[model samples]
Target: MPLPPDIRHGGNKACYSPMLDYVKLPTPEAFESSEDYYSTTFHEMIHSTGHASRVGRKGILEPSYFGSHEYSKEELVAEMGAAFLCGYAGIEQRTIGNSAAYIAGWLKALKNDKTLLIHAAAQAQHASDYILNRKRGEGEQIDEPIA
Candidate 1:
């Protein structure tokens, strides 16, 4: 929710703070394109959705170290959720490739468990739905292709 100054001189990452219930992302200038900026914001939004006050995903509620199973799974969900949002907004074409590479990196950390994508995708759909203010059984359709 807040585009705060980067901690590092030119960091290009973002984060969601559960304690403060907010997202902190670098400025738009840090990204190569507007699509990249929005995609990164969406990724952090998905992470925020996992907060205890929202969808209550354990990966976010619990403290999971980097590269841990929970951490990897959560990263996959956030990236996939961002991809879904990008597709819905008709901007996936600009960010899909980066999303795929990001997801692939997390998958590798998860030991390349193909099944995790399925599971993560389901959660991603839920996160995107929540973010979009859609209710369950309303319309589980995605009009745009994710990749």
Candidate 2:
């Protein structure tokens, strides 16, 4: 059988390309450093949350358009989702020493739009809950992601 994400320490992830042309997150896997893996996955998860079956974010799930409002909102959602997910996952915050630039960029995006953070946070929470609940078989909807 294929390795499970828990065993590989990877979270359900899509192989995402930051460029707007295409983005795809690989399925989650188990890794030794699951917190990082999960954090990254949470970013993607938050985007996928826009799917019709998920949070219904509409148009935001498409590839990120640089300097675009919708893209920035989705990025904020992913960032906030990852942070919140880490909390929900029980992983204490740690510095990989690579987040400063990312944090700054996200902050700028948030500054551009006052509601970006809040909306993304709320969406992240919903996405995180859906993932966790579906993982434990608490809900049946997540198993079928939107097309």
Candidate 3:
């Protein structure tokens, strides 16, 4: 006898993709926790930032051309952007389990570019600034600890 349908799959909708929507990113509500929801949404949003209609990352978003330079660069942007936001918001970093896969993908796109990390770090800074600015209201300064 076959196991229950739920048992066949994890039923955990936290992997950042919709059932019939491979092209579209997962929505925030589809996630179980706010952290997962927000992080996933933020990742996709950062990717969308590169959209040609917007930030001009359309070349990378295409599924057929996976792991190309454009795709790798954008992943760097999204990955670092996620890290920055998680840090800035005082949230725990999400587990990126497929380390080997990510490294391979990035390395392939970069052709093992020595400065890839440096460029990614810079883009992460911009992404962080943008997100912070979006949430900040005029004249609402963040409080710093007294030195």
List per-candidate RMSD values in Å: 6.3, 7.3, 11.6
Where is model 3 more than 4 Å wrong at Cα? Answer: 1-29, 51-64, 93-111, 134-147
If both were scored by TM-score, which would come out higher, candidate 1 or candidate 2?
1
lDDT of 3 by residue, 21-105 (tens): 2224345455666776556555654544443333333333355345666567767677667666766665644524333345456
Please, what is the whole-model Cα lDDT of each candidate in the order they appear?
0.80, 0.54, 0.49
User: Which candidate would rank higher by TM-score, 2 or 3?
Assistant: 2
- Runs off by more than 4 Å, candidate 2: 1-32, 59-64, 95-101, 134-147
- TM-scores of the models, in the order given: 0.83, 0.60, 0.55
State the weakest 10-residue window (summed lDDT) of model 3.
Answer: 1-10
Question: What is the lDDT ranking, best to worst?
Answer: 1, 2, 3
Q: Each model's number of backbone clashes?
A: 0, 20, 2
lDDT of 1 by residue, 1-147 (tens): 222212222355588877677777788898899999899888988888777556768788889899999899999999999999999999999999999999989988997575887888888998888788776665653322222
